[model samples]
Target: MINRISAVFLFLFFTLNASFAQQVLTFKGELAPIGDRVEILTDSNSTMSLRSALSSKEFKRSSGSQFPNLGTTPYSYWIRFTLKNESNSKAMGIQLTQSMMDYVDFYQVQGDSVTRTNFTGHRRPFNNRFVKHQTYIYQVPIIKGESQTIYLKVKSGKQLTLPIYVGSIEEVVENAMIIDLLFGIYLGIIMVMLLYNLFIYFSIRDITYLYYVSYLGIVMLTQASMQGYIFRFILPAYPEIADMFIYISTSLIGIAAIEFSKHFLSSKQYTPLLHRISYIFWALYGIQISLAIAGFHNFSYTMMLALAMVSAVYVLYMAVVIMLKGFRPAKFFLIAWTGFIFCVIIYVLKDFDLIFHYNNITNFTLLIGSAFEAIMLSFALADKINILKVEKEQSQLETLKALQENERIIKEQNVVLEARVIERTSELHEANEELNSTLENLKQTQSQLVESEKMASLGQLTAGIAHEINNPINFVTSNINPLKRDIDILLAALDEIEIVGLSDSTISAKQLRIKEYKEELDFDYLKVEINQLVKGINEGASRTAEIVKGLRVFSRLDEDDLKKADINQCLDSTMIIANNQLNNNIKVIMEYGELPLVECYAGKLNQVFLNIIINGIHAIHTKFGSTSGGELKIATYADEENVFINIYDNGIGMGPETQKKIFEPFFTTKDVGEGTGLGMSIAYNTIKKHKGQISVMSSPGEGSQFSLQIPIHNNQSLSHLN
Candidate 1:
């Protein structure tokens, strides 16, 4: 680097390029920026020495570009500058910002030859550098009030953006330390985001967070590689690894970013076409990595940057689509990605030299953008947590409302049935006294008993419905309190963060305090617990929704109307309602076949299935004492015009005598109050009403199998059944 050039220009230029005045830098202070105060001569074959460059007389100063950046040039660049020091300090050095330059040759010119020569570059081992710095630095022997001409040659297999600085030992150390401090703060933000999100990811087992964390990691690695820290600290001995790190990381970063967007925005769910398109960009990034591996550095870097811009735009567009479709989380995602894309746009522009001034601000634009994006994306993830909590609450409320409405309906129906039962009993008693005949009174009582059997079936149905709905509601209610508590903790943390962020105090001063607060709060533990609570609530709400759906199918109130219905569905709905009675014992297996819709009373058929299932369950209990080793199988098949159902249970069976009596009214194997003695009888009657056939087969100690055949085309009149 040229610390201070004297008033006289050091290198002669081509006549056409010699329009500018003499270029010289005289150092009066400790440190100075030699960023653009030097002239460069490009040698196509990299064969220029100090004496030859001095004789070439073709060096030209860049007029507009701040940092002399020639992107990925394999040739050589000869920079000539005159430095004069007027200060007392003589321990002056030249610093080259680009760490990946393959070789750097510094030649101190005295008369026509080099007086002092130093060699250092990326190709040299860390221990072989003139100075033990991450970047190239050469100690120049310059006395006070003396001017010297310095010639430096640079060549690399990477993008060449050279920002040179010249300063004394004290000044350079001070500058480096300040830069380190700024980087320290940036690293802190990244670490915080990684640890916090990583905890949540493990707790909830959400793949979106995995992608998000991976993206964070890749960005950090890529930025570190570009900043030379990866070489300085991570892989100092292995220059090859550090040289390839940036290319690999750049490809992986795009992949991670695309995956994170695809899931977080639910792009497949909202914009499937666009989601498919993301893969193209991902494959393109892969190709870029391949090119880099194949040693096409310049082409690959250009392709990588182009693809990055295109993919960033695609992701932003996807987020917008999802946001417009009412995905709440996409709002923050959009804002975050937009800021990052804006920065990327500028970085790409500067790298291509479309933006004239290529300084540190443009060079590290991606880093700044990434830091902002990471923080905002964390907010988005947190917002999703709140959304889930609210959705769970809303779901529970709706379920409760539905439960209340169903209870009211059931109660009203019960009241009507009770009145009918009372009136029938009164009329039967009056008839017994009026007729004074045993046969007549017995017949009336038998009719009332059948009606009572229906009421008992209704009671079992209601009980089953209540039991099925209870457990999931219990799950939901149990989590509400814990969920609220965890959410409050997160909100408090966020509030504290906001307060601290808005404060005017320096970050480093409060850094230790922040660390202490994190330990005390245990953000990791809280994030995990909160994710678990939300998941539990979601599962509960999902179960409740399923119960409601089954109930709707099972309790079709329009029993008198003939509607086309799938028998398999009717069986499933019955199973859902009868789930309570099954407990953990009696394992039920259902094999349902494709069946045409049958025009019949769906409610009546649901009742028939329920009665049969309940009876089978009771038989299983009677046989095995409900200690769990019983199986009940229900299968359905269909023929040309009929659908058949076969329900079998491995339980204590009945003989021919009991089988004949099973379908008769007022006959049951259960004790007095245990059953109404009309379950099978009613099932038989309901099948008869649908012009269907019912039969049963059993042995004394084996099991019972009941078969029913119903016509797929039900053309019979049902007025008699009503």
Candidate 2:
């Protein structure tokens, strides 16, 4: 009975163990090619594991196409498969277990679709459905096996049948978060920079800033969309736009570079021609954009490449211009453009797949170039501001200096004007004093001239009266001489008659007595006495008449009347009138030549001659006094143009200093009371009135010569004489 009980317990235990094993069975397999079938059969298994012949001793069971008999809840399994390229080209496919596929989906990342596929508990027909999100479970049969790569994406949620099966899930999540965060930061930085530059452009109205902002915006959009961020969220409907963004970003970058170069380096200073070329590139870029919008992306891309090349050439030209111009920004621009060029080359190489890495280096280089460009552009802007400030200050300083100089000049002019005013005032005062003195002297000279004229007129009248009295006295004297003679004869006859008186013896005796008385009475002595008296009276009368003539000539009565007169005759008359004063003290020499009868005021000219002769006589008298004698020479001659009278004196000659002032009014060497000082002055005035000039030549102790030059009458009659 105890043996039977132990057998029952062993059966129950075996049954229970089988149920547990069936409930938790696991399978392992390998995806291998055997003839025409791809099988997953395990090489070894236990009661708790699924039955499979997929693994071998030579190859470990890395993955399988199917896993049957795997339990539900609390059981976990993973599968791996190696797909090979059965054709010459690469094959792309996916492998997953049916249970895991129920909650998972398949997505083709290489095409322009965002479709999803689900894998469920059962295998579905592989119909190559293009629109459906279906898992591709089929393998690509290999002609000559070449390894390919794909992912078996497993979706794990709360309803997942096994513990989450994933490789480095945390790492993937962290990497995705890092990429998102980095992209966000990059976008934020780009947005901030773009907005900041836009604000700057608005504030400054600089087109360069606008270009820079646009370039950065395009760069951010290209990077964001290129990484599928924009496709994932923002505009999933237009996946092709990302490609256009790439080209646009590139073109914008080139344009920005050109504009920045122009702004920073002052393109006008050097590469004006190249700047025009850059503008052409910009126009080409516009054409490229047009083409791109027209859906000619390839042509647009080609044109963009050409534009980029042109931009590079322009950059190089600008670099050369900057180097020649010696701008400091050239170095920075050159380095930045070169870096951009390298970046573009790398991007091109990356597109060709000749390079294994993405164009991260290109991006890095572009960033570096942008940084340099920004720094140089900022420096250039600052330099421009500083230069403008300096110019403004310099202009102001120059203006101030000019004002100061003008003020200084005005001040100097004012000082000079003041000095001139003072000088002019002083001269005016001196002129006024001289005028007053001259006025006083003129008054005194006028008084003296009037007195002299009065005295001369009185002398003329006195001489005329004396001449009339002399005529009467001479007549009386002549008559008295004859009467006395007759009286003497009568008295002698009476005496003879008395003596013969008393007789008729008479007449004969009386006549004889008268004759005797006439003989004896010294009638000759009586006659001599009477004649002496008469001769004396006659001499006195003749002297008086001569003085009257001199007075008349000196007075120049009727001098205004114009008449034809002989110059020699006038001179002779003057000499005759002056003879008395010049008789014994001075000798007169007349060298008279033949002259015309000039039309002139004869009386005035005669007066002029009289004055000059008298002056000559006085000069000689003053020279020799009464003790010595001097000669006064007078000459008259006529030339073709003039009738000249020369009055020369061998007397005390005047010095040059005295001769120069000799004709000046009131200027005389004579004592104050001795001369009226008008003789030469009157002569000079009279000669001037007659349109004649009187010139004097004199030297101290050598006498003086006066030449009176007068115009000769053309119609005058000349008498030729030696």
Instruction: Report the number of the highest-lDDT candidate.
Output: 1
Clashing pairs in 1: 4-25, 4-83, 4-84, 5-25, 5-82, 72-159
Q: Candidate 2 residues 1-722, lDDT tens each?
A: 32443333232223222222111111112222211112122222221221111111222232331222222222223322333344333322233212212223232211121123333321222223222222124322223344321222232211121111111223323434554675576666667667777887788786767666766666666555444455445543443554455556667777776776676667876777776767777777888887767766545655665566567766767886786777765665566566556655554433333352232244244344444444444444445546657888999999999999999999989989999999999999999999999999997877678458436634533554554456646665776767677567757667766767766766887677667776886767767776776766667667666656655655557554556777887786666555556646677788999998777677666666766676677678878888656988888888887898889998788887998998886677877665666767767776777777999998888788888987765344322100
What C-alpha lDDT do the candidate models reach, one value each?
0.81, 0.55
lDDT for residue 593 in candidate 2, whole number 0-100: 93
Off by over 4 Å in 2: 1-510, 524-543, 553-560, 714-722
For residues 1-722, could you state the per-residue lDDT of candidate 1 as single tens digits? 23233112244444223323437668876676685788888999887755467666688886545477777666898887888887787867777766667678877764433566666666555666776766677777678888777778888766677788888866776766666676778888888999999999999888888889988988888888777778788777887777778788888888889999999998888999998988897778888889878988767877888888888998988998899999989999999999999999988887777753477688668879999999999999989888988999999999999999999999999989899999999999999788778777877787677668768876866876787788888888999999898888878877887777778879975676667677889978988988888888899899999998887888787455788999999999888888888878888898988888988888888888888988988888899895988899999999998999999999898999999999997699998788977788889998998889999999988989999999888776674432
The runs of at least 3 residues in candidate 1 whose Cα sits more than 4 Å from the true structure, single-residue gaps closed, are 1-22, 49-51, 111-116, 415-722
lDDT of 2: 0.55
